[model samples]
Target: MTEAAGKSYDGLPGAFRFAFSRSNSWLFKLYVAVALVLAGLVTIIFVFALIVLIADTVDASDGSISLLRSFFVLVGLLVVLPILAPVLFVARRHRREIGDDTGYDRRLASTGFLFIFAVYLGLVVSTPPEQQTSVDGALGPVLEVLYGLPSIVGLVPPVVAVLVIYGTHRLSR
Candidate 1:
């Protein structure tokens, strides 16, 4: 049997080499870092909002609060806290690897933006309509603002991702 040799791109054109080197630059890494951070923050915020919604639902139920409900909430936190953090971390790391190898920052940015948008959309769709109604006093607007925020804020993550990518590209050169 013949031994296999490692693959080489040594004979590739200068443009291909330059493209590969540029993708591996510190600037590209910075872009990936910022994208990952923004994606993480958006995910965390959405999860927190979801937790709060669940807690509020339990508290507002007409029946006496039961240990079962509290237990479920606790279980939810236990499951989600551990699972989500690492998943986000691993996902970001994977994205970094893809970006580094392929120079696919725009595609990564788009995917991250879509993920953030979907989370916000889910939050908005799941929220109770009653929660959106106006109330008297200073708390009314605040509650409304809080509940209405997901829809309004959904546009932000993608925009920020694009800006970060663009800014890093410009700064790197």
Candidate 2:
């Protein structure tokens, strides 16, 4: 019985690893594509926010920055540096894969991007707007803009991602 079962299993295909799967379903591709783009955007946003925070603190400092300000900057830098590693790794891998002759996995790229975006979004949404606005001077204005032009701001990422993906696909061909 065991021998027969093993033979039957061997004849079947391998298990589906979520990130590594090569299935060409449109829904899966869409999900992944959105995810990849989101990840990149989130990372960029995070780095930008950190820079803005540090800059604001420095500007406000009159040659006597508070210990709290210094500590916050130090902590933000430490956090941002580590977060950058995965983003850089994914980017480098994507570049190499695209340049290679063996064709790259769009799905995998999408999955990675989506994962990063989800994490970033989760963190942002979890934080109260009041706290975020207090920490970053730009947040208040940015939020106002987003609120004022919800339709435009909401569509930007998806539209840009589609154009980028389409351009890359065209170039690769």
lDDT of every predicted structure (CA atoms): 0.44, 0.43
Indicate which candidate wins on lDDT: 1
Writing each residue's lDDT as its tens digit, candidate 2 over 50-141 gives 67767778757555656655666664543333323322322333333333222334433453344445444444444444555433586776
Candidate 2: lDDT of 37? Answer: 53
In model 2, which regions exceed 4 Å deviation? 1-22, 59-125, 129-173
Task: Quote the RMSD, in angstroms, for model 2.
Answer: 15.4
The sequence of per-residue lDDT tens digits that candidate 1 reaches over residues 1-173 is: 11211121223232233333444444434434544455456457656766776677764755544555566556444333322332232233333342343334344433444444544454553466665566799977755665666554644544454455345444422
* lDDT over C-alpha atoms for residue 113 of model 1: 45
TM-score of each: 0.30, 0.29
lDDT, model 1:
0.44
